[model samples]
Target: MGQLVRGVWTADADFPRDADGRFDRAASQFRDMHVEPVAGRYHLYVSLACPWAHRTLVARALLGLEHAIDVSIVEPVWQDNGWQFSDRYPDRLHGARYLWELYVRARADFTGRVTVPVLWDRERDTIVNNESAEILRLLHTAFAPLARTPRDLVPEPHRADIDAINARVYEAVNNGVYKCGFAGTQAAYDEAEAALFAALDELDATLAGRTWLVGDALTEADIRLFPTLVRFDAVYNIHFKCSRKRLVDYPNLLSHTVRMYRLPGVADTVDFDHIKRHYYLCHRSLNPRGIIPVTGQGAYLRLA
Candidate 1:
């Protein structure tokens, strides 16, 4: 709920909304890239709990840059000061105590929401990019020569179609769930919930025969959509009130999700334990009692 103000990390607790109680996510502040792929020079700061961060992890694995890009996972639970690292968590890289500390170190008076899936350039000692979408593209192509498994998730010919599909999925499904969950008013929640299922229905219909979102080949579009779908039935269904219909109810959508998970190296990126704990425990405003549920195996079992 807080963001950096003029390069100074200020706890603005309620800075992300207009007065209407609708949830509005802030744009990521840092947006640049590393043209050269150097082993061990870039670090990924991520949270297993965050779906956006999860996308980068999946891309890193799929592109076979695990050895090239070092990663540090933060504890799933968020504190009042925001995401922090711990001895229990163990920073494998520079050993920063908190994620925000990385932000401050990068720019002494940095201001903005400190978000995850941060691509840090060790050589420059600054953030390469904080937006997950950008990170996914960078990981997919930037380190191609160094990739253990050389594959193009986003090919040149399919770039336009991939971008179109990504826009729809991101707006109506990926971020839509958050809009529903974090909505401050009935109106906002209603709009988000309706838009979410509508998009799901369209995707289900579209994927009735196709193997992937863009083409026969898996693209960044699929990676971007997968994390949210994986979490939908598990947490978003009941907790976020995105229950117009469970993902299992859709034959095509369910199969598509399973297909993505079954992709070699992709499953390892998913951590349901962290995913469940972070949402239930960290969002104090939503689940004030801080109770974690042990309910229906949900759609996750289908992925297996």
Candidate 2:
């Protein structure tokens, strides 16, 4: 819940919330125009811990655009400064210490949530886009001509259908868990939980007969949902009190999660350590002591 206020980092700014105490996620800033699909001129900034950011990383790998677009992964922890680069994952573009610093560099008076999965335009010295869903679309299509991947995640006929799937999936399953976890009251939690599981039940049934969500092959819809599903059992199920049903409890979802993880390059992006530590340790509003649980990542791997 930290943000830059006129280029100054604030540890505790007024976290935007509605009157009902529901968490209000800020809209990503850089999403106006398209980034030119040129090789070696753009960079992707992401955190492996964040599902939203993770979505972009998975799409990058799936498209086989490793050489075309460069990526710099921030460390797994969130401190006084929002997402920071570890000594291991230094900021390659500017040698900046914190992610928010890059935001300020782009817009000197930037006053918003400094989020990740930012499509950075190194040539123009600013971000191209920060929204993950848009980034997924751009990654799938904008770079397709130069990409080596065989399949297209978003075909024309399936566009409307995929958008429809994302509408519900984003509300109930993807953002639903956050609504439940961040709910300020029992009523909000209850409502969120009901919707979350209902969506999961419907989706599990929908996926019961097939591997992909919309069509015969993997689409942007699958990329959008996989991050949340992969994190559910490990973090959300326990830490977020999404305990009504573990991801494993649903056979189809568990199968789908296992399959998605086993996909080429998807496994590498699922950083269990980062995912667990970021939620357990960083969200001090929920976890004051910052004690990370000693859960084994193998438990999830064995589910497949």
Candidate 3:
């Protein structure tokens, strides 16, 4: 676990934990919105390995902004210095050797944790936003004029409802898994695990006959939750110790995951290789051996 401090990358000795050993996540530093839709001006810097970053990728595709906004994928592995670049994994927009360079270029004296899903404003030579939630929102609405589809993931009428659900899902499930995985004590793990399963159970029961999280149409809430759910059984179950129940065990959740994956342009955004490697290798404290599990289960197995 590492972070950028005032534009300088600082390698964390361990995951950020509270006095009670509860995992505490840092707030995203860069948060800016695009006032006007501009094609070929915004670039997304993402790591296929990160669930937070994955949300933006899904949003970008769902909004059909593939041509409007360019994207650069970082390598799956994270080293001591943090996310670096290579010829094989070149920064498509700039030939910078590391992601930190982009941050430095944006603000030479900038200090904060360098996380992915960075929306770069090439015109201003600065970061539009690094927070996935904001990036997803901008992709969904700000670029509506340039989008290929007419669907609004966060429609005005559903905004309030979506926000409420997103907050719960984000706290209990989206971030709950991390709390469990990064927990340094049994009490911390128990607390996170209980909340995680409780949320999942409620969600499964709620989606018994529904196709989406919010009524009939799919919304931003689904996109926010999908990356975590999709990775739950595969990586989080074992590596993160979120094994109360596998995602496949939940009929509705599994079906919902498949439905989202089957959506046009979504499956392409998912890379199990990156997901597995990043979790198993990057989080050395969780898995010192760094051995990746090879379940016969392909990345996306149909829920049986």
Candidate 4:
């Protein structure tokens, strides 16, 4: 709803919606900067509540990048100036109050929406990339040499299959939930809801026989879809008007979620407190009184 114009923050409404009231997400701006993997040289800024950001967090953990690259979390509830740093999760890098401050610091003339999972180049004082998909690849490939575990999420033999699944999941599931939630018209909502469930139905059927999305082992496709599924029953199902069926209704999909959650480091990455607070309290339009439902958090006890 708000963005920076040439380094200056403005509260004006500049949503890119078509006449049909369908939301069009803006692309990340810091895409071309090259990030070289150097221990303690880069820091990741993320919000546990954000699905896109969650992808990077999980990748960082799975690849054992915690020792190489540190992370800072923003407050779950977005403020007027956007994602802010509170005393509980302060900006250890610059002591900046808001996430936008880091953007302005990186590029004084930068103009765009300030989103996370930001890969900050501490030595250069610039952003390497803000796109989570790109950041995930960076964590898996560029930083693979530094990983403590000998694993390849995007193995060369299965790269094609993994990419194919990622494309379908990104449109129909990853971003689809958002399309359902932010639809401004009944027709738009209906269209998004139909596409979302169709994809879920297809995915459930696909997973009925296999444990992973692309291959026997975990891949990028699984990492990309897990965030959305993990949040589906909690936020998207109710707050997003995706009421056709809860994620638990799809037995296979729910099984996949628990399997992924039970992974070595994956369980540690989830924060339902941040997840619930951000959605129910932050989106005032969707939740006028800021009342957070108490039903969703218990569903993740399997991870505990």
Taking all chains together, each candidate's TM-score versus the true structure is: 0.95, 0.96, 0.96, 0.96
How much lDDT does candidate 3 score? 0.87
What is the lDDT, from 0 to 100, of the residue 296 in candidate 1? Answer: 55
lDDT string, candidate 4, 54-102, tens digits: 9998888888889999999999997789899999999888889999999
User: Which is the winner by lDDT between candidate 1 and candidate 2?
Assistant: 2
TM-score of 4: 0.96
TM-score of candidate 3 versus the correct structure, residues matched by position: 0.96
Residue lDDT tens for model 3, 173-287: 9999999999999999999999999999998998899999886799989999999988887799999999878988898998889899989999899888989998999888778
Residue ranges of candidate 2 with Cα displaced over 4 Å: 13-15
What is residue 125's positional error in candidate 3, in angstroms? 0.3
**Which 10-residue window in model 1 sums to the lowest lDDT?**
295-304
Alpha-carbon RMSD, each predicted model? 1.7, 1.6, 1.6, 1.4
Instruction: Please report the TM-score between candidate 2 and the true structure.
Output: 0.96
Candidate 4: pairs in clash: none
Best by lDDT: 4
